[model samples]
Target: MIQLHDKIFKPFISSGELDETVSNMVQEVTKDLAGEIPVFVAILNGSFMFASDFLKKYPSNCEISFLKLASYEGTSSTLKVKQLVGLNTSLKNRTVVVLEDIVDTGNTIVEIADLLANEGAKDIKIASLFYKPEVYSKDLTIDYIGMSIPNKFIVGYGLDYDELGRNLPEVYQFYKQTDK
Candidate 1:
């Protein structure tokens, strides 16, 4: 177990597992977007590691950009999604794929999709490293999912607890027993 601020997290997903998942997702994405060069817009901070690994394994040529959004203040979501950094790239009439670290409430995904749609994107697809279907309430579809995890707080592999544990190679779930 590891401590981040006042919270403790235990190993959940290993580094190898994450890598394998990413590789599989890349294969699937490559097949679907075979002819067209899609623009990958990665959500910043949490998705930095996943985006890097994903882009590195992507076999075909693609354009990449980043947008930073925020909703979480600690272990819980603030229930408000704010776009901290806006997109500068022209998404007009382009096939755009959004890369996210995790999708639970799906508010951020909704916001991004709306923004892309307003920009007149030809098509929009959402890709996430981790997904919690139990808590996802958005009508939008997540096209690519690396892993479907339980509704639990996790850190590491770009996910964090109070801005810590992002450097950890493996994913860790919050340990309820350690809260005391």
Candidate 2:
């Protein structure tokens, strides 16, 4: 268990589980990207940890870049996305792969995809470490999903709360334990 702010969260996803899932997903990604060299655009901050694992395991020849986007303030999404930094690489006529830590409301992903498309990316693929399908409201499809979780606030494995808990090796979720 871990504490972030006033909340206590219990272990949700373990480190071993993360390694196994990422290993399996790498095979699928390699097969899907057999003939092309894709450019991986990793969303910054929260995605740094996931991207470190995923990109290391992704066998396909690819280039990597980063874009920083912010939307969440604490456990809730502000629903208003902002770009803290911009993309420097030219995505023209290239296959682009976007790696995200989590996809919730999908506002940020949609916005990034639009910009990439407008810059002439030939194809775009989205990969997310975690997905909350119940609360996902965007039309874009997540091409690679590590896991589907309930609509609960979680932290760890690069995910943070008010800039804490990102260093944890496993995921932690809000626990509703009570003592009488």
Candidate 3:
């Protein structure tokens, strides 16, 4: 359990479950990019841990890069995406995969795809460790989805609350205590 500020969070996804899910995701990603070497552009701050573990499991010939984007203030999405850092490589005619920690409102994803497209990326795919279908409002197809979960607030394995809990090996969700 993790207590941050006034919130109490209990373990939701254990380390074993997370590893298994990531293992399966790696298989799917390899199969999808079998013929092409894709450049994995990891969204920084959140995807650092996921990207590290994913690349270790993925034994394919690919390139890795990092770019930082922000859309969240506290635990809620601000609905406006801003790029803190830019991609350095030329993605012209290259297959690009956007690796994200979570996909909620899909605002950040839209901006990522648009930027890649404008830079002449031949193909773009979205890969995320977690997704909330209920909250996703964008008309975009998430190519790789690790798990489908509710819109509950979560933290761990790179997901953080107020810049904390990212080092946790497992994912956790806020627990509400009602009067009994």
Query: Any residue pairs clashing in model 3, and if so which?
Result: none
What is candidate 2's lDDT per residue for 25-132, written digit by digit as tens? 777788899999989999989999988998899876789999999999987899999999988899999999898999988898999899889989999999888999
Any runs in candidate 2 off by more than 4 Å, and if so which?
A: 176-180
> Weakest 10 consecutive residues, lDDT, candidate 3?
171-180
lDDT of 2 at 8: 81
By lDDT, the better pick of 2 and 3 is 3
62 Cα displacement, candidate 1 (Å): 0.3
Report the error of model 1 at residue 121, Å.
1.0
The order by descending lDDT is 1, 3, 2
What local lDDT score does residue 142 receive in model 2, on the 0 to 100 scale?
Answer: 95
lDDT of 3: 0.92
Clash pairs for candidate 2:
none
Which lDDT values do the candidates have, in the order given? 0.94, 0.89, 0.92
Give me the runs in candidate 3 sitting further than 4 Å from their true place.
177-180
True-structure RMSD for candidate 1: 1.1
Q: Write the per-residue lDDT of candidate 3 for residues 100-168, one digit (tens) a residue.
A: 999999999999999999989999999999999999999999999999999999999999988989999
lDDT for 126 in candidate 2 is 93
Candidate 3 TM-score, true structure as reference: 0.95
